[model samples]
Target: MQTQSVQKNNVHKKSRSSLSVYLGQWNAPVVGYVFIAPWLIGFLVLQLWPIIQSFYLSFTEYSLLDAPHWIGSANYENIAKDRLFFNSLKVTFTYVLASVPLKLAAALFIAILLNRSIRGISVYRTLIYLPSLIGGSMAVAVLWRNIFGTDGFINNLVVLFGFTPHNWIGMPETALSTLIILSAWQFGSSMIIFLAGLKQIPSELYEASSVDGAGPVRKFISVTLPMLSPVILFNLIMGIINSFQMFTQAFIVTEGKPYNSTEVYALFLYKKAFGSLEMGYASALAWILLIIIGIMTLLNFIASKYWVFYESESGASK
Candidate 1:
């Protein structure tokens, strides 16, 4: 009888322990969801709902006034035939391709310079980063227009140098390039990231390379480049995404003028939705942009596996 009683007690203890463990596991997910509930709700309401709605609208003809009429693939078909759509796409592609590499390179160079132990380095860093904060504002865009205007600072400088003055922003040929330069000038945010990445790299690696008779350039190429590849990939992807979505600078400075030479994808979409009252078509354009960015980011992630070396994993294997 005592043996049976002890066996029953052991079974009860095991059941209790199992129940407690199950409750603990359930509590964790509950707590995690509670903490994330606000963001999740906001995302669904603000971001996800709009995206889904836009996808549905992309197949319809809705002018934000009347009921939406189902148009199937008509919008996509029209985009293929539209010359302005092609022009806007060309302009956006040009900006992304031209600006991203130049901006990232400039950022990396400045970051390297700032990473050095120099006097008043914090002041220099702050000054460099200030442009990024101010450059995206409407006021700065107005300032950019003045700086590149026909009778503005650039032309004045050209005249001072004994050259005939030419319209910079007023000309279609130079207008887009001016915006590209403006974008490159605000490389501070990327520079800050690069500086942080540079700091994270172990100094011992450089020392070891130097001990092996590696020069500065050689050390950079062999040691620093490999370690910084992940950060570079991150910056490259983000820069491309941001560059592709550039709108405000061109919108404020050029107003898509000079025969719509500066009408980027975002501006084109805006004009379609607000200026022309074609919200359905604008939704299609937004989806297309999203797809392009998604594909590019995916390609970058796939490519990074070959080059990006994580210290923890790579060093462990070595």
Candidate 2:
């Protein structure tokens, strides 16, 4: 009887221990969920819901006024057949192709210059970066429009140079170029990233190059380029991605004016959604844009294997 009582006591203790452990395990996840609940809820309602809604709406004819009516792939069909849609694609492709390379080059060049230990370097970097900080704003876009306008600062400078003052944004030939230049001018973020990459490149490599009788140009070609390859690749991909979304500059600066010469794809999508109240069409366009961006990103990654060299790989090979 005493042995039976002892066994019952042991079983009771074991059950309590198991319960405590189960509760402990449950408590941790519950606490974690509690902390994450707000962010999870916000993401689900705001971001995820809109994204899902857009996907669903893409198949339906949705205008803010009426309930969305389901139509199957009609929006995509219309976009493919639209000439203006093609024009927007052309403009956007041109911008992405032109601006990204130029921006990366300019950013890298500026970063190389800034990498030097100079007096008031931080101030200079700040001044240089300030434009990019404000570049996306409506105010900056207005300033850009004014600067490139017929009687604006650029024409004023040209007038001083004794040339006929040309309307930069008024002409088709110069309008897209002006936008490309504006995009390239906002390379401060890229410059900062490049500067950081430059800093990471070991000074020992430079010293070793010098010991091997390498001049500035030779060392730059051999050491600097290879060392900065990964950074260049990173900046190139990001620049391309960002350039594809070119909108505000085109919106405020040109508004796809000069015969739709500057109508970037995103701007066209915006007009379809808001101006024409073709929410379904716009959603379709958005999905197409996402696919295009994904393909481009994939291509970049594939191409990186040929060009992007890592220090780890070098170390491993050696």
Candidate 3:
């Protein structure tokens, strides 16, 4: 009886040790999965699922009121002849090309000015960044519309300067330009990013360039630009992406008015999806936009080989 009891005790101890080993091996992974589960689930449901559905829906006619009818490639074929599609694409390209450079230039300029060591610098940054905080809101867009209206502040200010009052957002020729100007005005985010990049740059490089009799422009060209190239690449890609996806300001301010002059790709997509309820067609447009953005990003990266300097690759020849 004693021998049997001792064998049972040994078996119990062995089982407990095995159980502990298993738990120990899985503990970290289990915790990690638990932590990531929320984000993973949200992404799968909100983002990934919608993407897959949109791709599938692109091949079918799906109105909210009815079932999705399989009409393979019809939507894409229609898109080939869609005049509005072409027009919106043109407007979007113009906005992206024009606004991005202007925005980057403004951001870099402000960043340089703010990078100075002086009293109340933090306050200045806060004040400057304040515009970006409200830039994308509906209220801001409404305010912008009011500001550029016929009897608006802009016209009033111009009238005071002995100029004829013109409606900025009323005319087709100037409508898209107003949106572009608004885009450039909201450069605070990019400015902040540029400022951060400037902060990371080594003062030693500037001092060395100064010792070599390099003036401000020469140092900026040689030392500042080379060091800031990576940051520029990052900002440029982000600006392009954001500009391509711009909708809120255009929607609230212009609503693609004055002969669809400000009809950007996103606004057009929204109109197709919701206004006309051409779900399938809108889905195709969305996919095409994704492809375009992807191609542009790839091209940027490919071109960046010549311009985007990395500190880690300093020893490598261009």
Best by TM-score: 3
Question: Candidates' TM-scores?
Answer: 0.89, 0.91, 0.92
Candidate 2 RMSD computed on C-alpha atoms after optimal superposition onto the true structure: 5.2
Judging by lDDT against the true structure, name the best candidate: 3
**lDDT tens digits by residue: candidate 1, 1-318:** 999999999999999999898878886779799999999999999999999999999999999999889999999999999999999989988889899999999999999989989899999999989989997999989999999988899999999999999888878898899999999998989999999999999899999999999998998899988999989999999998998899899999998878988999999999999999898999999999999999999999998999988888976998
For model 3, how does the per-residue alpha-carbon lDDT over 111-215 read when each residue is reduced to its tens digit? 999999999999999999999999999999999999999999999999999999997898998999999999999999999999999999999999998999999
Clashes of 2: 0
Clashes by residue pair, model 3:
none
Full-model lDDT for every candidate: 0.92, 0.92, 0.95
Off by over 4 Å in 3: 1-19, 27-31, 316-318
Candidate 2 per-residue lDDT over residues 283-310, each given as its tens digit: 9999999999999999999998898889
Angstrom error of the Cα, residue 26, model 1: value is 6.8
Given candidate 3, what's the lDDT at residue 170? 82
